[model samples]
Target chain A: MKIEVTSQMTGNVWKVVVAKGEQVEEDQEILILESMKMEIPVVSPDDGTIIELKVEEGDFVSEGDVIAILEED
Target chain B: MTKQVVEEQNELKQKIDKLLEKKEKYREMGGQKYIDAQHEKNKLTARERINLLLDEGSFKEMGILAHHQNLHPTMEGKFTPADGVVAGRGTIDGREVCVAAHDYTVLAGAIGKVAETKVARVREWSLKNRVPMIWLVDSAGVRVQESIGSLFAGNGRQFFDQVQMSGVVPLICALMGPGIAGTAYLPALADFVPMVKKTSYMALGGPHLVRSVVGEDVDEQTLGGSRVHTQESGVADLEVKSDEECLKVIKKYLSYFPSNNEQKPPIKEGVERAEITINERLAEIVPTNPKKIYNMYDVIKELSDDNDILAMKPKWAKNIITAFGRVGGYPVGFIANQPMHLGGALDGDAADKAARFMNICDSFNIPLVFLQDIPGFIVGSKVEKAGIIRHGAKMLHMVSEATVPKITIIIRKAYGAGYFVMNGRQFDPDYIAAWPTAEISVMGAEGASSILYHKQIRKAEDSKAAWSEYADQFRNLIDVEVAASNMLIDDVIDPRETKLQIFDAVASAWNKKVERPWKKNSIRPV
Candidate 1:
């Protein structure tokens, strides 16, 4: 079972640092979102593999949107 | 030219003669000791700190000469100014504030007979002025010499004023001395406290006093250091290396929220930093292998507002990362988990730290950001016996009751109780987004596979191999589009588009904002 990485606050998907199938540790910055002149990095929960990316660059989001999923280690 | 030079010298000599007379007058009053004490007293003056925090030339002096001179009418020339505490009014960042800085050189900054009155005056002035109060505490304790007649005096409840005003008005304490005895409680009473290391300490009593009473040798540093209060106890909000650093941190903390809940915060010019393409890099950030721990800081730095991110209690809460940062130009609260520490599990200290922070943010109406990377609450006999359940529940209550705009970005694990506490679907977060590389499941693939297919795997030709094979099947690689295609989560977002979506959601929440319609809710639930 893996955990999905989502945006904590709403913003634009400014950049996606992790690629699908790449490995990630807990608290590692997985994705970056720009909102209200701030950049928020979405991070991973466990030592896991990135399985998918949901939102694309320039897409607007609200709170609780899934940005990526991490298959647990 | 020679004649003009001679005239200038004469004027300069006259000026020097006047200075000598004034110095001699001060010397005659109580000899060099009095002069030395007075000059030394000025070194701990709040003038410098006040200037750094407030706009220049904004501080207006109040009760500067309001000392105990009235009681000793016969000794008219024996009056002291402000009784070693400089209490005054000032505009800190255009917001009105009343500040009182203790003069440490004056009898070790002991509270005098009338010192409490001066502070009370400042506190009352702040309440009347409808402004925040800043107390620069560097005192040893009460003045034992003048403690005789204080009972009859009317200033016994000065400290109580601070306590009463805690939730009523914002109180910030900057501890700049070896915080001992009573000074320790003052900071604890305030909403926020920023302390300087080595120079600052907070203790109910010095270790020597405690040791004397208990017959144990307790060292001072071990008893009341910045590390103990900020890291272990969570008494102080911020621990800075120097006095200057402490002042700067105080300014930054006050910048985010409004002066009070009744008002909206002033939107300052937004931060300007080099914008990097952080969203586009998310695809390669989270690893495909479930076991490898990727760098969450990279995503945090990318998603953070330029240089607005300031992580707090970093050493204590290794699992949950709590920070103070800004969105646009307004201050907001940021909480995330780091899988690197205890697999991003919530512990007792981390929960307490985040809970208190959540209370403050929610009370002040600051929006919350949850970086959900939590496996679950820490289990095991040690954690349970240590009261992890009660402490973890505190964090849950704070998050759920927080009425401010909340957004949850689940970057990785959100299993069990950690899911709900992190503002999952149950909390009804304003916006919920997930990345394409998400596996929304409980526990983990390894545990799930063992529980579900243990008997079947044992029957296989190779039991151990079958277990591993079954675990792999539960992995995201085995089924990529299962959760998203089913629409279990609201939407799956690309890493690059995450920022834009968060902004939109916050905007939507802002637009849909409806404050508590009742009489501002009577009680403050802890």
Candidate 2:
């Protein structure tokens, strides 16, 4: 199953913690967003391997933007 | 003569024996086997639960002999005792309460036509007598055999009555067993729902139905157990270890509410101020830095009498704290913004939570106390798409319509529309007080300054230093002193005198009859 990880808030992408094809556990941080002077991490919703990274560091992503895709086992 | 008299007495004895046999059947409650099964599950029988809930020997059962009258072949021969429910009037700690406990032993506690009527009748009684109602729901939905025509048509009355009794009398429900399909509405309508752990489960559709429709293989526990409802869904208010514990929790909860909307909450004697004293640490509680988060609950505890607070919907919309507490031994509702969560912003969920709570407090005539530290309602496309405007309007409508005495204490930041909806002077709050730490403004200084001086700051030799200077200048313009000087707030009070000020305000407004303009009713934003 392919799971789309969406940004919950609108913010500038501060850092990308995981790379494409990397194995990630559920609730592991995929990327961090900077908004309202706060760092909010976008975490994986399920245990999966990162198949695609949609946003780069410093890219401004709006809420509901798909930041990455994870292929679940 | 002696022989005739003896024969007559013997005949009377035979009539008494038949009456005892009927009473024995009533006590059986679906026979001994089912009763044993309930015990094995570590659950109290319906009657036993009622006995535990009410004061000793205070229950007066209303419909003990009620039974199903359906003549269908399948139901005709069945002996559905008490119509699978035991409803009655009872006293919990000398306070009168009506209860309807479903008997799981009887036909799996299915709601028959007669049982539905019995439940509705007790609800009406509760409404008329102005007594709180308790529903011990453990039904396996409606009786399938009797789910036809008028029987199905009349089912809506139960839920309708629940809505009618919503703010009038406290409606509490305990989920002791499966509450699926139609039965689930009981808990949903209740002011408070306490579900027993492990055994209690509720769902609109059961596992079998899910499997058939969605091809999901799930067990009943995994689908709608106490853990899921209490922790994830926010449907159940509390989870207890057993049926007895659930009853105890309900008793404690009802003690904080009045019997009906027309009456004031019963006051507990000897409830003194907190022993630790609030005055000393009150000044230091709110940090000087605007970005730092402090616990709003700690402030509430300091202001409340004896640190007593009964929080509602604690898990959902955590940014806004809604609770029932006392000041100077008088009941009042506390609506505060928790800076610790989401910077105390009024999001859609927080707005909905506060609005509903305000309506309840207003209906019951409980005074309102707002401790404002709200930054503002959340902005951006995300919240807007989530219908923040409609949801946020609910708070405005509720605050405007609330007839109860309102006192707003601005402890920290009160920016933008958050100030207006949090019972600002425009809302005609009875009293408005502010602490020295309060910063009342249209928006936070940083955001306002950045927007207003964007060009100048960007062109400055040092952009960060330029932005900070502009922000400080903006912040100085809207401090607590400015607000007080402009007469926007009633007074800038000392942090230590907060509880006394709130108490005096509520006490003074207690008997003042304020006339409201005549209106049928205003429409609330949906």
Candidate 3:
């Protein structure tokens, strides 16, 4: 299964820490999203590889909208 | 008929002689000076306290000089008069109220057999009159000399009266002296308790008793000082240094509410206390560096009306500040966390203090100004053991339940759940403003870079140097340019102009109408 990490709150994506198809582990943080000027982490829930990053650099995401998806090996 | 009148006059003279002889006998036994001194030291003489609180000469003393005398031969000499409590009825600044003032010097104003009856009478009067009740408690709890008999007399009637009167009419109790043991609980059930520092002490038992009961040793101040009560455990509402200040707080607090909940709020002058001016140069007051810290107190002080900030528990909750300050002469509750203390983190004590203050202000229809500059709650295994999760969540729940007008100002840092707890947009703040220097992120740049971008920097030849380079890039995410792209915060206002903007925002929300039950004096959770 892919690592589908979505935003928990709505705000601008302040920073991207990982690139597409990057290897990730369970509980590994993938990116930092800023909403209401607060940075929230988009992390991997399971050990996987990022297949597709839905939001590009500096894109805004809503609550529960996917920010990135990871493909499990 | 003239002979009959002469006979009556002779009988009166005989009675007067008997009273004079009794008075002389008491004087011989040293009762005269002791009774006279006690009568002199009463909070105010019956006439004066009544006049100051009630209409001049309006109070009708229900049971003046009501006393208890012994019918049994062994108890012949033991008689108590009003048991040192003065309870009566009169108007307080035009509003009628039932009042009870304890006479401190009289047996240290201890509750005795006759005094408990007087307390019951005034409590009953408060219930029957439907007027507000103001108690001036300056007692040393129950009389040790009277002991079990007095406790048995006072056991049930007084509490039943307080319970029946709660929320129906505002019962204001002022602890003006050494309030030990059972006497402390009077204020515990009161709608408000205004205490005088050093003079007042409220505890279930005195230090000696506490030491004996709990196997701990401490003095009275260490046990029940005003500082301990107001700041540590979150008990006392307002603490004044003297008795005069206590009376003033009582008057001011009463001004906010009606005599009873049935009436409407008194129309204020809406007097603008001079326009709070800001220097044009204040726009650049916030520095660009994320690491550079500014004194939030200076900013808050400059934004408030000149000499108008009334800080509460100031010395205790240093990091999380709370005050009742006037902006343009309109009162507002201000809550700001000072980053200088523990990096502006919310500890269990601060969270509990702020949450309690918020609930009280919101219940009274006061507007709130939450100054946000927080890193997060203090995190560690130690904090976990202190039940920080439960206490922190309690604050979050209070923020959600608050129905008052809320304005959030992001002065510097807003990270993690601290943002949500600090009147963030998720709680539907009426307006959210930020200083351009604020870095609103999940975590600080160094922490984020260390945890998330570790590999990218580790691959570089100089890992330490590469880590520093990545931190700067992460800091760039929290600049004014990024904030402008997101509409989360309403506006980035000048640091000096914050007061004027917040006043305008709150004034615009004035005349907000919300109705509830007729008797809605919120009884706090036990």
Candidate 4:
């Protein structure tokens, strides 16, 4: 199953912690969003491998915008 | 010895035998076949559930022999045991409460006309006696056979009676099986609703009704299961795995509440430590950095008595947490901000959750403890369209109106209106304290600097550097000591002593009283 990880808040991507084809556990931070003067981590919802990386460091993403795609393990 | 004396004695014995026979038959509850089927689905019978919830041998049943009076042509020669409802007064943990459990073995636990009367009578008994009411609903809605025609006009007094009983005493509704249509409203007006994972569901319309009326073929679980209500719809409070767990949770939930609004919450005695002790783990669980995230549950568990907390609506509105726990053996409701989700920003749903929890705590006389680490309400076009203002106002109104003893601990960022809604100094919190890392300000330095120093930064040759310099200066001004020195907040304390501090604050304000001019009621925000 493929799952699209989306940004929960409209903010600038402060950092990308995972790379394409990288395996990640559930709740592992995929990227950090800086909004409202706080760091909000967008995490993987399930244990999966990143099949697509859609955003890079310093990129702005709106709330509900898909930031990464994961292939379930 | 006259012959008349022997004849009278024989007649009395015969009457007693007939009464015992009737009681035995009604107690069987729709026969053994239906009872076995209920067990196959991992659900307990109505009597079994009531037994588990109340104390041993404490239940005093009130309408066990009630039979339906419905005379519709479809109901000819039909027999209903207790009118499909088992209702009466009982004691949970030795405290009085009234309960109504739907006997699903009888007519699938449909609410017949007489069953409705039985439930209404119990509800009235709860109110008149000022005792808490619990409803174990597992019905297939109203009995259509008995209520299919124009006779339905006289129905629906239970909901109206529930509205009148609201806030006067605690109401708990547990969905142990399907609660379709009329059965769903029982939980809708309840204070606490727990749903059994696989066996329980509540929907205004069942799957069959949806298929026929809307032409959408949805299953029972998909339509309104534990996950749907507890996670998505925010209708139910907690989801338990089985009927046994559901009954156990109800007992735990009631421990934090009083029998009625007029009485003080029953304080547990013989706590290993009545006095609060300084726990060093609190400092380790929270990060001092403003941007870093930590689980609020870790801090809550360390502060709560015996690490016991009943989290309400735990899965819904992940940004804000509402839970019931005891501090130094005193029951209190904790409203904390979860920094891990959405930067701990309050959204419409989060606001609604917090506000409703606050109302419950206030109504039940349970003190409230707020742990603030909020940034502010989520801003922008998206939230605006979602009516964040109305939702935010509802929280603001609730905090202002809540007369219960309120204790606040500013764990970290307490910026903007977030501080106000989280029982800040302005909301008349009984005791408001901040940690060394707390920043009480109108807004964060980064956002404020961008707007206040916009012209200065734009005019400078090095705008980026100028902006950073200005923002740093603003950040330096946002200090916890400034508020403490000015006496804006009560005190600045060490993070390690938070539990002891909160316990002291709650104990000191145990007799708090606030006076206000009487009115019908203030118009609260939606």
- In order, the Cα lDDT scores of the candidates are 0.70, 0.86, 0.70, 0.91
**Superior candidate under lDDT, 2 versus 4:** 4
The weakest ten consecutive residues by lDDT in model 4 chain A span A37-46
lDDT of 1 by residue, B298-358 (tens): 6666675664577666645666777777655546678887765555668787788788778
Instruction: Name every residue pair that clashes in candidate 4.
Output: none
What's the CA error at residue B306 for candidate 2, in Å?
3.0
Better of 1 and 4 by lDDT: 4
DockQ of each: 0.02, 0.11, 0.02, 0.65
Candidate 3's C-alpha runs over 4 A off are A1-73, B1-63, B68-79, B89-99, B113-133, B144-172, B189-194, B211-217, B237-239, B256-267, B270-297, B454-463, B480-485, B513-526
Candidate 1 chain B — worst ten consecutive residues by lDDT sum?
B23-32
Worst 10 residues of 3 chain B by lDDT: B23-32
Residue B443 lDDT (model 4):
88
TM-score of 4: 0.92
- Candidate 2 per-residue lDDT over residues B381-478, each given as its tens digit: 87899999999999999999898899999998899999988999899889999998888999988999999999999999999999999999998798
What are the clash counts of all predictions, listed in order? 128, 0, 5, 0
Q: lDDT tens string, model 4, B1-526?
A: 6899988988898988888899889989988999999999999999999999999999998888899887778788878989898999989988999999999999899989889889988999999999999999999999998778788898889889888888999999999999999889989999999999879999999999999999999889889988789877999999898999999999999999998888888878865454677788988887767667888988899989889899999878889999999988889999999998977889999999999999999998999999999888888888899999999999999999999999999998898999999999999999999989898888888788989999999999999999999989999999999998999989999898998888888878988889888999999999
Off-target runs (Cα >4 Å) in candidate 4 are A1-7, A10-62, A65-73, B272-275
Sorting all predicted structures by TM-score, with the top scorer first, yields: 4, 2, 1, 3
Badly placed stretches (over 4 Å) of model 1 are A1-73, B1-44, B68-80, B145-160, B270-278, B281-285, B449-470, B476-488, B511-526
Model 2 fnat value: 0.00
